[model samples]
Target: MASLNVYSALVVLFFTRAAAMATKENDQIIKDNNCETKMGLPCVLEAFTSIFKTGTISSKCCGELVGFGKVCHTTLVKRTLENPLFKDLSPARIIVKSIQTWNICLALIDSPSPSA
Candidate 1:
């Protein structure tokens, strides 16, 4: 579990390609799009950190990691745009590309790619 977390971050830093780059700039042109409404990713992370007890996976975390839970691979990339910290993030291409890239990277390492 410990190893997975670090690898996950590294995967985020590695992916340089993603299909989402095509129209990512003009994709979701929502003017007042707010993220608080979709803060599920952070909530999922906090939930894991709270349940990650020591080197062993807590039953709580395991339950969330297994079936019915999507946190095992999915990271909060879409939530970044709403985050005030990364709101002004430039090169929307890189941000959007990284999100899709990490998602695929995580899918490859955590599970099979979407039957590509």
Candidate 2:
């Protein structure tokens, strides 16, 4: 029926608009995170390699982690959890230990120093 076609067209238009909005939103988040200029894909990949091996996150990488807003942080965590590489690497255990270590580093940076 014509009404059914109209409904289908509206649904498609709504979804297309939604997808464009989502893309723009994600672009903004990426910009806020300085992903292109600061957190390049190659750099993050390299840092993660070292992190997984020695459980030592470089200061640069740590800064990037702390820079992320809560939503971005949770999104990254979820994606990392879902990655097959993490499963092979036993990511949960590594993340627990790493969090403990990174916390110390993060705490120092987060704290304000006394001014003379």
Clashes of each: 0, 0
Candidate 1: worst-modelled 10 consecutive residues by lDDT: 67-76
TM-score of each: 0.24, 0.45
Error of 2 at 22 (Å): 18
The total of clashing pairs for model 2 equals: 0
Cα lDDT of model 1 overall? 0.41
Task: Pick the lDDT winner.
Answer: 2
Best by TM-score: 2
User: What lDDT tens digits, residue by residue, belong to model 2 across residues 1-116?
Assistant: 99999999999999979756765666667667655455556546644554466545556666665654344543344445555666677767656654664574477558776799
**Cα lDDT listed for each candidate:** 0.41, 0.59
Give the alpha carbon lDDT tens digit for every residue of 35-68 in model 1: 2233355444643343222123333333433332
